[model samples]
Target: MEDLLGSYIIFLILLFVETKGIPPVTLAIIILNMFIFLSPALGVGEVCLSVSTTLYGCEWQRLALAPLHHIDLDHLGFNMASLVWKGSRLERRIGSARFTFSICSFGLLTGLTYLLIKATLSFLLSDRFNLDCAVGFSGILFALKVINNGHSCDGNIPGPFHIKKRDACWAELVLIHLLSPRSSFVGHLAGILVGLAYVMGPLRMMINWITGKETSSVRFAECCQLSRNGHPDRDSDGDCQSTCLPRHRRQRRRC
Candidate 1:
């Protein structure tokens, strides 16, 4: 438990440093590589599940908790490095707190979704197939990429970047096909849906509610108005003069 807490603290520290403009990818890759190398020397094999079972005396039932216990120092280092870079860039643009929250929330959501899908599949295939425990950071990475691709805008404007959404989605689809050919497409699809939901669902609502501003194409015009006039504040005539006067008041002013 102390080791687990320590590892998490290190991750947070790395994340903080990454947000401050330090590139942490190389460090992550190094850590993961070390784990890969040491696992064999430690007689635990390359499979993380074996190491966890040997070290902690846990069963396959605890696979879901493996990520918390088994620190694939190398794989996770590399994964966190990439995510930190990507997430930090996004964070810089969107503000650190919001970006951090988005990444953590999306990761948790993806992890839960992966677990549910794996559990259901395991139950369904109990008679025919024996599924081994699987653990990795791939799902979270995929989710982040999907959300970033889908929700990205061209300099805070909308429409022109809409085409990129389709392109990004297709790129991920192709990559999944090439990489995890035998993997269930449902999991990937779920990740994509979850990514989209993070953008268009809860994250969007939370940001809007907290910042009192819209962050979607559907509300682009409204956002423009708010930006121009300042939100939650009205002009003398009760018109949002930041962008334009209200329709009724325009007529009244003319009269």
Candidate 2:
């Protein structure tokens, strides 16, 4: 860890590795993450450890920037590679619109989860985990993996261990924490919970109903027109055909 540049060499090599058929939103996230990593800010901001700065006030930006910032080049490279692999399956399965919504929603949701867990521990065990500042996309990556695993019928990660798909996220969570002892365990665990929330909890239904202005632009299986007055009108060839339906129901919008 002391040799940050040395750790970056492997990441540089991975830069040339080609991954085909990356979905558009996935690619955009990768580019945005990489750009932020290389920018003058280097993903540094009032985030990272801002969750529980003190009892009086919180930076709030941590909820937004933490997922996008990385501590090092190696971290950025590894996360981007994982996104390419995971996003290929997730974004393609659910359509870029829903996947995009999930990513944004999951990021904020996981941060709140992280804070709650930290606060709980701080109260009970005096762990003071909430004051801990952390950054990176790995937490959300874990969340995505949980959802991806849900879509698998056979539902097991194919490997020497034959880990059951249901438990794979927990296994990886432990493995990642062990390997990188410096990483925040609470942040990662929060992501796993968020994924579970999305899979079996109220998250999916909530996302389905909360109509953002961007909802009209999403690709549903069939385009439903929103009348100019802002209600769903009868199906017509009007350009207003738009937005998402429930999970596993919507197909890519042709219009």
Candidates in order, TM-scores: namely: 0.48, 0.73
lDDT of 2 by residue, 71-107 (tens): 8777887888888877766777667887888899999
Model 2 steric clash pairs: 49-133, 221-251
Indicate the TM-score of model 1: 0.48
Weakest 10 consecutive residues, lDDT, candidate 1?
A: 215-224
Backbone N/Cα/C clashes per model? 8, 2
lDDT by candidate, in order shown:
0.47, 0.70
lDDT of the structure predicted as candidate 1? 0.47
Q: Which candidate number maximizes TM-score?
A: 2
Q: What TM-score does structure 2 among the candidates reach?
A: 0.73
State the displacement of the C-alpha of residue 143, model 2, in Å, after optimal TM-score superposition: 0.9
Over 1-255, each residue of candidate 1 has an lDDT whose tens digit, in order, gives 457646755875767664564434324433554454345333222333322242235354333332322244544455555556555444444555555455555545654565566556656776222243334555555666655554332232235445444256556666666875744354455556676675566766765576555322222123223333545333442322333434323443321
